[model samples]
Target: MRNLRQILLEEIPEFKAKGEAFLKGELGKMDFKKVSGGFGVYAHRDGKHFMIRLRILSGVLGKEQLVAICNLAERYAVPMIHLTTRQAIQFHKLSLDNICKVMEEGLEYNLYTRGAGGNYPRNVAMSPLAGLMKEEAFDVVPYAMAANAYFLQRINTYHLPRKLKVSFTSDKADGSQATVQDMGFVATLKDNKPYFKLYLGGGLGRNPRKGIPVDRLLPAEEALYALEAMVQFFTHEGDYEHHHKARVRYIADRMGDEAFVNCFWKYFETAKVKGGLDFSPEMPKYTKVGKTVEINHIAITSQKQEGLYSYYFHPLGGQLDYRLLRKISNLIEPMTDVHVRLSMGEGLYLVHLDGEEVQQVAEALDADNYLLGVEQTRSCIGVPICQMGILESQKALKAIVDYFKAKGNIKKSLPPIYISGCPNSCGVHQIAGIGLVGNKKKIDGVLTGIYDVYMKGKCTVGETHLGELIGEVQEDQLPGFLYDLASKIEATHQSFDQYMEANKEEVEQLLSK
Candidate 1:
């Protein structure tokens, strides 16, 4: 990790110079992007401001890391720190003057931003409650953490077909989305020994695909071997010339299912012979780290640790108010073993706390968790910030929340709601609950915003499936349609999936109308 930090630090001067050239109009947009993506820096649509993503490995942000981020946010006058659906924090509206500084300072805490945006191995995601989930086969935090280190150390291996994403989930729920990553490891147990079922090449986006199993339970110790194999396989078989068909999923498609499996296995064997990647890290030690006032308003859940709990919160649309996070930092900074883990769904969990600590922290940073089922929506920072975005997805998320708040006591057992600005699935709209992809249509000459609706998708271990596209609805009509449907689901007293199963015709009628 120290080596990775030093490597990232050494590259800053060059990046700064290139950034300056771009600012001076000496670098074209595409040329600058080619240089900037590897550095995890992006200029705002205005071309004056910038934003940088800090990849928190396995979604763990220690107290030191959070405090450092807070200081930077304050130093930059950043009103909000955006949380991405992939478990990273982004500081928006940075200037070229401070963007490089932000990158350098982040390395002080060993938080690497390099390789975050490029066609490199992105953040290694994991179950936000990895060690804490009671149903997990075993704690996968250590292994996932090891893989993060392994990848960061070798990130200099450039020019993959596209960005590679890997994930580990401690249980079948696939909370970290192991079933939908380029290379996935879902923890399992055989005779009380921890193992992982490998899923390969599944991802969300324009041509979404569910990961294919390698047909065997991988020994937990050999997790890194599997990951390294993916790197090799992707490198060898990936289509370098075509941009759209470069992802690992495309390799699987081009090679055919059986051949893809066989080729990946051969690479896996080669990785094993090459050796040196043994992974058996000690589980993270949590010194029994609380009060009991009211952390249970909605966001609190118990950890596997007997008395310890984890508190959760979502700042609607994942735009965390810097002030709220600052307050939380102040509360947890002095405390031991308390840390934050950003969930893949734009929410976060405060772990290693007892009941007392939970209440203390919750009281200090007041928040209203979105109405559990139907109200909460995860969205990408679309339009202005994203070069690929087609809509203001965050504003759309806020609209959904505002609509529900205005309708008092509207109950729902709905699944997760995901909104993406476009078909790229940054908002993870392909799996689970209700999915919305922004679109536009010109009726006469007036262009109007609308959303392509998808429903009844699942992302659990054995049940992974893409969301079904039902129909398109005008953006303005979205809230009403959802509210009306949710009211009916509530009357049925069934979960969204269960209700949909029994009332498919009725649900489709509602959606169509």
Candidate 2:
């Protein structure tokens, strides 16, 4: 039986054809949810407007596409572009009448918004530094792009048990958070041939689980086939009767590891017989897409590939000023081939730049404080825009940054922190060194906002683990506590993970109480 979302997806073209009348509140409540969510248009909690999420697969976007998004937002919504945890762009507070126009306008730039929401394969993420990073095993962009393109082609028509999350990682050290994905591909080299380590059934949001390894080594050629098999297994075996337990993770949880693995193998063997899908091993090479500028002096993060350097710009909680982005886009327009990657951390990365162009890039971005790194922290857009939001997390993130600055530790190296407005994990709190998910507690008979704390999460090439919850902190108490926590940790250890390993009991006693 087709899911309600798939049924809705099939009818969207017709709804879109009756665009004006449909937008004018002609559809019923259930029909509205189906028609809107199927096309990535979500009603704001207030029900007065909608939000459209764009599918920015592979976390990369071109200047033309960026400008198109800005134009759409400026003309219709609040003129602000939101960057989501999945590395996609979102437009908020848009009216129903303007959604199709915005989506249609985006189509001109080859930017599509379909399958960005609902029970479908959403954006496929990979390490934003894929080909440009020096430490990567090999470029995984080709594979990531191939998977994204393949899925998007079928997303509009395919009915899934629930949303499927997919990811790929080229670098183990900075492993694209692949362990939390429904299906993950980690790059490896075996016998001088590119291969991948496959992981399955990992996810966060109410029930968090790290992906279990399916294979130690899978030939690169079999990637697409393996992906197909996984989807097939999920479609047939996943629990559709209970919406809450429809994800692949729940299915794996219900069946023990041995049973789940055995079932997956059956699908895998069948797919293997069907043969490998088309794949390319070539890496993208950018050779000056635009003009070039000379640089006298400017320091960037690091030189990845001799003569090419990368720098990151953050847009506080992923809310980018469309006007500023346009300026930055124009600034790098000279280096036409330079890749602009939308990082999962909600930052923008300018990659593959000539050493000489660094000064001009820095100067252009410096005027507006865009070069500051405070936005490095991951945060989710909070209430009341998000239907599930429990706290205004972005505001809390700003408070943390301000506290760091006041203590003169703004630039100090601390553990990676992630803030989610609720348990949905939109901020990826599960994998953070120190994670905070907002909640409310009754204090003195009054409900007060607080954050549930998670500590000791780890993500690497071979393993990914969700952090353990220590306790909760009152909203008013968070800044001071975080400062003390950072100071105490800095005094004892070089890294938070190391500190946790050495003083688990002591730390737990200190925080949980």
Highest lDDT among the candidates is held by which one? 1
Cα-based TM-score, every candidate? 0.95, 0.89
> Could you report the Cα RMSD, in angstroms, for every candidate shown?
2.0, 4.2
Candidate 2's C-alpha runs over 4 A off are 1-31, 286-304, 367-375, 407-413, 490-494, 498-513
Residue lDDT tens for model 1, 324-378: 7888888887767889999998888888888878777667655545536555788
After superposition, the stretches of candidate 1 with alpha carbons farther than 4 Å from their true spots are: 289-297, 366-368, 371-373, 511-513
**How accurate locally, in lDDT, is each candidate?**
0.85, 0.76
lDDT of 1 at 92: 89
